[model samples]
Target: MAKTVVQEFTKGLWAEIPPFRLVLGLCPTLAVTKSVDGGIGMGIATTFVLVCSNILISLLRNVIPKQVRIACFIVIIATFVTVVELLMQAFTYALFLQLGIFIPLIVVNCILLGRAEAFAFKNKLISSLADGLGIGIGYTLALAALAALREILGNGTFYNIPIFGPSFQPFTFMVQAPGAFICLGLMLAGMNMLGKK
Candidate 1:
């Protein structure tokens, strides 16, 4: 049982990592990754929603009618998203603004809904918790990594702290919209190559 729980958790890290392996949650993944702070912020918010909603949905899975399961999942997800938004607004208003619509949009993030319908709703509570944490952390890591690359190249900083010498010129293009797609494409290609091996 313990091994199974561990398996459920670890799978989200690499085997089914939302951004790279699964190619899920691209909206915020692309939009908010220009800086490490934005990436991490959005990731944590999504994680919070994912874990909370997963737990509630799992607890009520049997109670929900089959015909309305999808609707029920959305409602549950939206509730947690509102909580996250309010908390962020009160504490980290800047990040709250930085993340903006993406926070509320978490209600529609495929990772949450997909996990609800595919894993959480059918699984035991403990397994659902593990799945949520694993996936959430995986998503966080993906955002942080992508943000680090973009920030370091585009702004010559990591988390807004300078790393390169003053003489270094920032590659401004890396932080732009076109850069998001190119960088994501490159990362996807890399993941695919590694998967083949």
Candidate 2:
């Protein structure tokens, strides 16, 4: 039982990463990852929601009717997301502004819903928690990577710390929508290449 739980928990890192492997939450993955801070903030917010929703869903799995499961999960997720959104607004107002709609859209992040339906609905509490943590971290890491690339090239910084000297000219495209696509495509290609090796 312990071994099985470990395997389930570990699978989310690469086997079922929300963005790269499962391709679950792309909207915020692509939309708000223009800087490392933005991506990290989004990741943290999503993780909070995922962890809360997963635990609640697992605890109530036996009670929630199958027909209304999705609705129930959404309500649970929305509540947590609202909390994170409000917290960010009050404390990290700048980041809150940067994340904007993407923060509220956490309610729609397929990763949370997918886990609630696929894993939490059937798993034990400990197993469900592990799965949520693994997937949340994986999603966060992917966003951070994208954000790092964008920030370094577009803003000549990482997490707002200037890395490039005065001689370096920022690549304006890296901060744009097209740059997100480009960065994602390259990262996807890199992952595929690594898998082939």
How well does candidate 1 match the true structure in TM-score terms?
0.98
Q: In model 1, which range of ten residues has the least summed lDDT?
A: 177-186
User: In model 2, where do residues sit more than 4 Å from their true spots?
Assistant: none
Please give the RMSD to the true structure for each candidate, in Å. Answer: 0.7, 1.1
- Of candidate 2, the 10-residue stretch with the lowest lDDT total is 14-23
TM-score per candidate, chains pooled: 0.98, 0.96
Root-mean-square deviation of candidate 2: 1.1
lDDT of 1 at 133: 93
Taking the tens digit of each residue's C-alpha lDDT, what string does model 1 give over 19-122?
99999999999999999999999999988999998899999989999899999999999999999999999999999998889999999999999999999899
**Candidate 1, superposed: residue stretches over 4 Å from native:** none
Clashing pairs in 1: none
Error of 2 at 151 (Å): 0.7
